[model samples]
Target: MDPNEVPDDDAATSGGALPRRAPGPPRPAPIAEIDALSGDPSFMTSLARGLAVIRAFSERRKSMTIAQISQKTGIPRAAVRRCLFTLAQLGYVHDDNRSFSLLPKVMSLGHAYLSSTPLPVMAQPFLDHVREALHEACSLAILDGDDILYIARSATTTRIMSVDLKIGSRLPAYCTSMGRVLLAAMPQAELDAYLLREELKPLTDRTITSRASLLQALAAVRQNGWAIVDQELELGLRSLAVPIHDTSGTVMGAMNVSVQAARVPVKELETRFLPVLLEASRELSMQLL
Candidate 1:
């Protein structure tokens, strides 16, 4: 299954009543201007709007009418139509006369990043080793805005979460083990800004909804060098994560092992899985050095 594809059933769960895929960060409205390039004639609002139109189609909304695209992106309908036409001409989108959908060529945009960056490529072998040793799904993710974006993964056959978490999957930073570890690595002012800007919504009964509780959790992750999130993102999913550092001791990303809560209790995760995860993280860190 493609990790980027959203499951047909949004409410699907492995062994719990609530949905496994927690809500991601709310999509921002369309940009009115390129703030940094305010007076630059080279800065093109049309190009920015075109990119926005491409982003309008996601896993949930795979295809959309021009009107739908306009509504989602806050771009004018005519502008959306023009963007779609241009994208179709460029072979980036497929237009069936009624609605438009992205084509495989769109993957090239992400490919450019993956090809240029060594982090995902170097982390893959380490993730595979962790998955083999722990017999669980392992992934590498970096904090993107208020969410954690999966950049590499080694998945197990057994599904731990309802959502198909591929290389580009995004999950809330406040409710995931990887997110906690990445957030803990942030400088004090940046973390405060994130807390102030993001609205924390409870996904399950176990989710930490309060800023105070979340701050406390981040404090623990910072001090302990790792984090364990038990059924916070999904009721039946538990995850343990450690920060991956570079040569300069800068936190580059997070590596995590996720398992079903029923099969692996918190105790086993801490005692059995945590050490292995830490070792894998250390190995990856050394490679960076």
Candidate 2:
């Protein structure tokens, strides 16, 4: 049996499982101390709010009014207006006198990161190789607070999930295969802190909401050095992930192969896909070293 595959009875071995709670809406991002930071000369509240305004725009929300930006970012309308005005003046935003939208200049910010970061550049060829070999979507993600942020990806035309995933996509850590692998690599105290603070809202029927169950699942990932999530993030999407380590053997991120759950069974994912994913992660890690 694959070491990553935990038997149904594994939950019974774990002590004191929390009672399952009814699913609720996903938790909102914690509000930053914008007011407190305004007093600090060293802290740049204006710059922070300006960045927040830029982040408010997404593929789904291409254009928005000042009121909508304020609502999305939790910034006051006065501050949001000032930030948008500054961004527009700087040629980063385009205003049609009604709704404001980001210009192509925004790509420069992401471009800077992609240009400087060796991880994405070095991992691209390996990611492409894995995608081509298995004919599945492959992605590289790093841990960002309680979420996994996709920094790189090689995808097929087929859509496996409800969300349109691309670079910069963020998903909850507790339920995703890449998220689990990254979480498993975290120090015990840090992992404990994350579990204490983040609410594990169920994203799907199979999502693990109980803290005990999640801890047990993470333990299995730690032991096996890989994670397989079956429709936990979204229905019909199953993924397998392995951690990418640096020269120091510290895990920096995770790489995953995603496939349609209807098309691939978990057994085949472990037997066939896991080896290729591990090989890709190893190749990427070698370059990092």
Candidate 3:
């Protein structure tokens, strides 16, 4: 059962209850997270390299030698060896002399997230319902620069967009449904910087192309608690999004359902789609600590 689902008595085990929490940090971010970024290029470069090495091994390339890693990640063999050794020492990887792969221990990283993190757990059932109710692809996305990075997704058999909609895929946040929700949650200074940095290239004819216009849209997202974009990211695409907040009322993420404009109209989206999105967001917030 969820922590919120149980009362004080139900939290007890055979011997004792869960330890009481002292006042911790403002936000209970996952452990092993990097501190906030600095503008230093060298530091960012190293961090990127380390992440690249980890990204080198996926479902297809589960085990790789130093040469294979060098070929995949475009790092020198010596550098790949060094990183592998470091990861092995950190208990995040394992090797059997010839090849290397991640250990179950490494899962603790995302586990540290999925276990203690409140939103994902709550979102699972809600996503299922949203997909069933909407008859389209539904997903959750977190802010990642000028892009909305999909963290979790559920899709109907009839795909909405041509792009392969994988969980980790990223697209221009300004054009997608999820991005507007995150942008609406940001402080004005950060929003201004983002607008200046993000090139206002029109992804399609329907995309917002000016900073003034984008900010006005974001303001509407804040006031209305959701956003809808039609053919903004790709041709013939339509999507509606709602903001999901955590216990602290920060924008935890955005959830959206994407459909083909030929099949679903804007009126149907606002009337039939928006209610389900709102209910799911509300259900997700109740589970947050």
- In terms of TM-score, which candidate is strongest? 2
TM-score list, all predictions: 0.84, 0.84, 0.67
Candidate 3 Cα outliers beyond 4 Å, as residue runs: 1-45, 52-112
Q: For candidate 3, lDDT tens digit of each residue in 159-203?
A: 667776866667788888899989999998998888866777898
Per-residue lDDT of model 2, residues 70-143, tens digit only:
77776667767778888999999999998999999988998898888899888899999999999989999999
Off by over 4 Å in 1: 1-43
The sequence of per-residue lDDT tens digits that candidate 1 reaches over residues 191-216 is 99889877788899999999999999
On the 0 to 100 scale, the lDDT of residue 127 in model 2 is: 94
Error of 1 at 75 (Å): 3.0
How many residue pairs collide in each prediction? 0, 0, 0
Residue 139 of model 2: what lDDT? Answer: 95
